[model samples]
Target: MVKTTGFRVLWPACSLALCLLMLTGCPGPGDRMRFDETAQVSQQGDNVCFNITDARDYQPANMGINPRSTPSKEKNFNFSPGLTVADGKLCIPPSFYHFPDKGQFIIEYLLISKEYDEPRSFVITLEINGGHIYNVTPTEREISLPYCRYVMDNSVGTCQL
Candidate 1:
């Protein structure tokens, strides 16, 4: 029967479309990630503390890659955990710190997208309202000084009075 034959072809086509949708995902406008700024900072007395914002894109909750695990695609969300002290006189290591996380998939039934491009990054300038400061890197040797700093930093990150 012609109707039966059409159903045979139609079934497979519909199934394939469904699979693609699941893979690429259908992110609505709000689903797309917003500004990807790098460091989020705050100042208290003579010291400043900052942490990276959530790096997950606006994709479906299932689409989020485990940004905190080692060798996992989600490590891409790592941001510098910067702290400034000694009177805000230095940005220290000059580079930002990236905190590592153990990746955990919220849903075992879903697969993370194969692609994990680096997250968006930006430099921020803050008026030191009460102190002086500088940036630091990730690989700098441990500090003997009471204050903390960054290591392997690549730039002369700055602070303002």
Candidate 2:
């Protein structure tokens, strides 16, 4: 009777182990997402605008916006597509461009999500016109920008240089 009970317990354990091993070779439920960054630039007169979008839509529960800081509170820019508490992705608006007087402008792109709940999450920096202009980092959670750099020249209404 003791041996039979031990075998029964061991049988379930062995079956579970085999099932786990088989599952390891297959793709996970959360492994279907392909996160990447896309940049769209448009020019209006002397002002150049750059729009960056993050394309990763699979898990609705795994998407959101991060937070950041700026020099001007009145001009404090948030995610272009806005915060993603309801949605999982963010579309960053075009960063306006004016002739730089000196130095370089640094704009940061932050990815915010609930995967890791925290403040002031992941940061990606963008350099504009040799002046540290604007920084847009995400708040709330961690995110990434696979393709995040773009430049637009409004003199032609397109991204030239």
Candidate 3:
């Protein structure tokens, strides 16, 4: 007579299922986006300051700053800023100025995916009005790569969660 626990039978079945799922489970457009990236933005006497809070599992990327003014015929201009690296984290000092009303600051960067080894682009927008920072929105991003994630950050910069 052989005495066997249920663990042996369940282990094989679970292993087989996991293997099949892994083989077939490729990242798709329906995959949930990971809003893990975070930043800190504050208004100091009509000046806005910005800093990156958490960048774990994200590769260092080139930072692009795009400033746009509403009701202006001039096209938006993009420029790459010299980002400061402190403690291996990227930081953008308070240097940009927005109008007292109707100004949009779009910060763009391409972070390399740690899991899929692909480049993922992100755009963080700061809407300013009347010496106040109103919204920090992560614009709707399209996931072009199959195995990459739609990684973006969410912060109004007024409260901590």
Candidate 4:
């Protein structure tokens, strides 16, 4: 009887340890957002241009402003943002403005998904310079991209989870 009880306790502990180890070694969701495209912006006397095609293409679901926070008890699992969905992608435009004095900006992208009765929240940050851009994942780790900056300002407001 004592041996059986000890086995039961040890089994749970072993399972938990294995789960933690797997999570630590696996890449996170933010790591998946790192695209392999040139994100550089060229400026010609105040004219700036950059292509967001790669980023837009692999944009993970719920990675936008006003994502669906509540799950519906009825109907198919259709999600809706507070505003209209544009081209099947929720558009959360950058509100961060880089003034001459402001060298850095922290943009936040809140991701919320409903499962059963609870909602999950994930936050992503983007660091931007005049011609440089970096992506910060939900883990708060900084990832430097070649030429893309996420503009996060007051205009990029928060949504409740």
> lDDT for every model?
0.33, 0.37, 0.51, 0.35
Ranking by lDDT: 3, 2, 4, 1
Write model 1 residue lDDT over 1-161, tens digit each, in one string.
99999999999999999999999899786575433222434434433343433423311112121321234333333222332223322222323422122222110011112256433333333322224433322111211111233222233322322
Per-candidate TM-score against the hidden true structure:
0.25, 0.27, 0.40, 0.25
lDDT of 3 by residue, 87-149 (tens): 434445455433446677765566553566545454456777765675454433411223433
Better of 1 and 2 by TM-score: 2
lDDT of 2 by residue, 1-161 (tens): 99999999999999998899897866776655444332233333444333433323322222222222333343333444333321333323334223343432323344444554322322333333443333333222323433433333321112233
Best by TM-score: 3
Off by over 4 Å in 1: 33-120, 123-161
- List clashing residue pairs in candidate 3: 100-130
**Which window of ten consecutive residues has the lowest lDDT sum in model 3?**
139-148
Give per-residue lDDT, candidate 4, residue 12: 99
Comparing 2 and 4 by lDDT, which wins?
2
lDDT of 4 at 1: 100
Candidate 2 TM-score, C-alpha based: 0.27
Q: Is candidate 2 or candidate 3 better by lDDT?
A: 3
> Which residue runs of candidate 2 sit more than 4 Å off their true CA positions?
26-132, 140-161
